[model samples]
Target: MQTTNNTVLITGGSTGIGLAIAEVLIKAGNEVIICGRRESKLLEAKQKFPQLHTRVCDVAQKSAREELYQWATSEFPHINMLFNNAGIQKEIDFLTGASGLYDEESEIETNLVATIHLSALFIPHFLQQQKECAVANVTSGLAFIPLKIVPVYCATKAGLHSFSISLRSQLAKTNVRVFEIAPPIVKTELHREAQARKQSQRGIAAPAVAEATIRALKNNHYETIIGEANVLKGASRIAPKFFHNLLNKVATG
Candidate 1:
């Protein structure tokens, strides 16, 4: 798909991968609208990039997602791209059984449910567009290989990965192009705040992932697994047990 001149809406666009994508897309001359739950964060992003359109809607709630779709479509009828980028990551120690009930809900709601529901809400609108349209779901390397500490987060991504495959098949005959961009660990507030300082710093830059995504979208790659994520995916397919042990060891150590 052509990158420039398309009106795109990105969820959780205030920071991290979402914000990075918004910045790059804006630079490419695309009309970018970003939605998040935090008004302050949205304004901060807007301050950084005056051209970015901001919306405060938590996609985790069904009502909020619906409202966002209605508002965005009405405000920007030409919007033809949806980036399901909103997500949360937390380290849950299931062994200790200390994780709260709300933790599971937050991860599932934001990561998996919101992605599916938002995509459903936007697909028909995209199909009505006079030009080519696309939907890109931002999953993670954890989808292929689970990090035991963040079980729910990994599971949610894995679910998104599976859903993307089914979604692409269903929309194969339609005008919408479905893409799944699974990123490796990136140095962002989301990752940094959830892990130890050293491990967090070891991540790839969010902008690097954004650049790779742009290149993949330009090349029409349906499954854009970036950087070390590709290694994880390969390892998962080749030696699941070994990788699982290795990853868990590193995570715990």
Candidate 2:
């Protein structure tokens, strides 16, 4: 897929990895629109990149997702790319029973369900276009190897990975290309809960992931796994048990 001259919509574009991607795409000469739940962050991001079109939409809500699709497509009819980057992570201990699972925002809904729904909403529009289009899903290294502390988040990412594979195969005969980007731990606000528990959060910078994304898109790489994520992906297939134990051991230690 060509990297420039395309209009793109990115969910959760206010900060971190999403913001990094927005910066790269904008610099690459693509018209980028970003939506997030927080108005303050959206304003902040807009202030930084005045060219970015900002919208406040919570992807976890069905109504908001529908509204976002309508508003974006209506506003930018030439939109050819969708980045399902909005996600939330939580550290839940299922051993404490259902108490730990009852949160106002669900990881499954935000990370997995929203991505699937957004893809479904945009695909038909993409199919009708004469030009090429793409849907890039932001998954995690944990999708391949479960992290004991963030079980739900890991599961959601795993589901997303599976969905991306199936979606890519189904769309193979079409102009729409499905890409999966799996990045390892990065220095971002997503790891706040784990950081509060004093877990090591040292990882690559967000721009590294963004740069990898650009390279992947330009090279037509469907599954782009960055940094330590490459190791996790390989280990998951080659030595699942050993890596699973080692990963959780280090995460819990």
Candidate 3:
């Protein structure tokens, strides 16, 4: 993907890795549009980066997704990139008899459903464009190795990883390059909240993930993994038991 002369839209761009990626790409000279559920966060992001274009959209809701799709097409017809980066992670103790009635839907909705819907919504518009376009899905290292505590979150990321694979193959003849970014646990508010909920283990910084992602984009690396995430993905193949047990310790501790 060219570093400049393109308009990019990122979901959950108000904070954490999304914001970091937005900052990185925008600084590289692309017109960036970031959407979040909170108006205040969008306002805050606008204040922090005055060049940022903000939109208020709760992707968990179908109507909001439709509105966002329509608005993006009408407002930024030249958008060549869609970053399915917005996601929610929650720690649920399945052992405590957390039943099916529990509301763990946010993780599935925001992380998986939104990605599918957004991809479907934007692909046609991208295909209509004359320029080379791309879709970057922000998956997790956990997609390869599931953490039992956050079963739903891990499951969603895994599903997303699978979706991106099929989407890429299906669009192989198109100009849009499907990219998957598998991040290691990053030091961000997402981890802070997981820690507060007694869910996830400690992780690396968001800037590191963002920097690695930008480099991968520049080099056209389709499936990109950073730091320990690469180790985890490999360990899940060769040392599944060891990796699973190690992560279980962090959740149970």
Candidate 4:
């Protein structure tokens, strides 16, 4: 990746990790477009970073995803980078799960299916680009070690990791680059309250993950893992049983 002078699209770019990535890319002199479901959040992000292009679209909607693809290709013809960073984390217990109001449908629809759909929509367009083009899949360390509380969320990420590997291999002869970013628990609103409940445990700063992303792209490291994420990824590879036990302990307590 050239790292600058190109256009980038980041999903869920209003706050937390997405906002952090948007800031880093914008500062690096790249044309950046950020999309979120809420217009207010998008406006808030733009207020903070005046140069960021904001789009109000929810990736989980099929029509909106199609429109996003069309708008990007037509308006930002030079766009060459995509960061699939939108996701939702829900605490669910299948034991007492079926409630009248709460459901896990959105978690799967928003986090997993939308990603697959958006990637399929953009892959061909990315291949036709004349410059360095890349599609990044933001997964998690929990993909390697399931946090039993958020069972569906963890499963979706693990499944995405598998899909990314195959997607990369299929696009090996093409101009597009496929990347998987496995991040550890990051200091973001996604799990801030739960983490706060336990003072001894904490997450990596979103800034650290954002900066590491820049470095990873610079070095062309496709499967990027940082900090304690590396430990989880390594443990999944080296000691699966141990990792599972540790994750179980965390979830229970």
Candidate 5:
């Protein structure tokens, strides 16, 4: 995929990894449009980078997803790249049963379902474009190895990883390219809940993930595993039980 001169739409672009990506893409000369749930956050992002086209839409809702797609494609008809980067992470203790699952945002809806729906909406448009187009799904290293505390978040990413693989195979012969970007725990607001619980929030910077993602796009790497995520992916395949225990141990410790 050509890195420059492409129109891109990134979901959850108001902050964190999404904003970092928008920054990189804009600097690289791509027209970037970003959407998020909060209008104030979008305004802040717009103030920081005046070039970004900002919209407020929650990707967790099916109607919002459809509206975003229609608006993006209609307003920016040249948009060829879609980055499903909007996501939320929550720590749910199953010991509490159904009470832990009653959140305003569903991890399955925002992280997995939104990606599937947006990809389905844009793939046909991308196929009809004369140039190469791409869809990059921002999954997590947790997708490979389950993190016990955030069960739902990990499950959604795992589902997304599987979907990206299938989507890539399906689009292999077409003009659309499917990419999966898996980053290890990054220092982003996604860890707000964990931070509130006094958990360590140390990890790679969001820019590292953003830079890795651009490199993956430029090099056409279908699956780009960033940082310690590579270890999780390798260990999951090589020594599943040991690493699984090691991972949860570190988290609980």
Candidate 6:
């Protein structure tokens, strides 16, 4: 898919990987519109990058998701790209049953439901475009290898991984290109700000994922695994037992 001269809408674009992707694509000469739950953050992103079009939408709700799609399409009829990048992660201790039911539900709604719903919402509009169009779903390395502590988060990503595959197959004959970006843990505000900052030091930089994604789109690589995510994919396929045991040990320790 051509990266430039396209109008793109990214959910969770106010910060982290979504913001980084917006920066990269904007620099590459595409018009970028970003939506998030926080109006403050959206305003902040707009302050930093004046060219960005901003919207406040909580994708966890069906109404907000539909409203966003409608507003985006009506306001920017040329929009040809949708990046379902909004997500949240939580550590749930199922053995002790420490996480609330609401938390788990939110993870499912935001990560899996929003991704699928937004893709379905955009495909028809994307196909209507005479030019090439694309939808990129941001999943995680944990989609391939489960981490016990974040079971729901991992499960949602795993579901998203499957959804992307089917969506791509369905759109193969159309003008839309389905892309999945599975990135190794990146320093993002998906967690508490302090924890996210510390994790950022240990994880792959968000910009690295953004750059890799742009490269993947340019090269038409449908499934883009960035950084150490490839290790998770390879290890899961070759040594599933060892990978699970190792991940459990590290997570528990």
Better of 1 and 3 by lDDT: 1
lDDT (Cα, tens digit) per residue for candidate 5, span 94-142: 8988775757878888998999999999999998899999999999999
> Roughly what TM-score does model 2 have, to 2 decimal places?
0.98
Full-model lDDT, candidate 1 = 0.90
* TM-score of each prediction: 0.96, 0.98, 0.93, 0.94, 0.97, 0.95
1-253 in candidate 2: lDDT tens per residue?
A: 9999999999999999999999999999999999999999999999999999999999999999999999999999999999999999988888888765757887888999999999999999999988999999999999999998889999999999999999999999999999999999988889887777666467888999999999999999999999999999999999999999999998888
Q: Can you write out model 3's per-residue Cα lDDT over 1-253, one digit (the tens) per residue?
A: 6767789999999999999999999899999999998899999999999999999999988999999999998999999999999987777777767564247448878999999999999999999999999999999998988888678889999999899999999999998999999998777766765667555455777888888888888888999987777887998889899889997786667
CA lDDT scores, all candidates in order:
0.90, 0.94, 0.88, 0.85, 0.92, 0.89
Give the range of the ten consecutive residues with the poorest summed lDDT in model 1. Answer: 192-201
Which tens-of-lDDT digit does each residue in 39-116 have in candidate 6? Answer: 999999999999999999999999999999999999999999999999998777677665564853488899999998
Residue runs of model 6 more than 4 Å from their true location after superposition: 96-98, 103-105, 191-200
User: In model 3, what is the error at residue 90, expressed in angstroms?
Assistant: 0.8
lDDT of 4 by residue, 1-253 (tens): 7798979999988988899999999899999999999899999999999999999988878899999999988999888888899988877778875641145337776788888998998888888888888888889998887877778889989988998899989989888888888888887877754675662266888888999998888888989987877888888988888888987786567
Worst 10 residues of 3 by lDDT: 96-105
Give the runs in model 4 whose Cα sits over 4 Å from its true position: 100-105, 199-201
What is the TM-score of candidate 4?
A: 0.94
> How high a TM-score does candidate 3 get?
0.93
Q: Which candidate is the best by lDDT?
A: 2
Runs off by more than 4 Å, candidate 2? 198-200
Q: Which residue pairs show collisions in model 6?
A: none
> In the order shown, what is each candidate's alpha-carbon RMSD?
1.4, 1.0, 2.0, 1.9, 1.1, 1.9
Error of 3 at 238 (Å): 0.8
Displacement of residue 91 (Cα, Å) in model 6 is 0.7
Question: Model 5 RMSD to the real structure?
Answer: 1.1
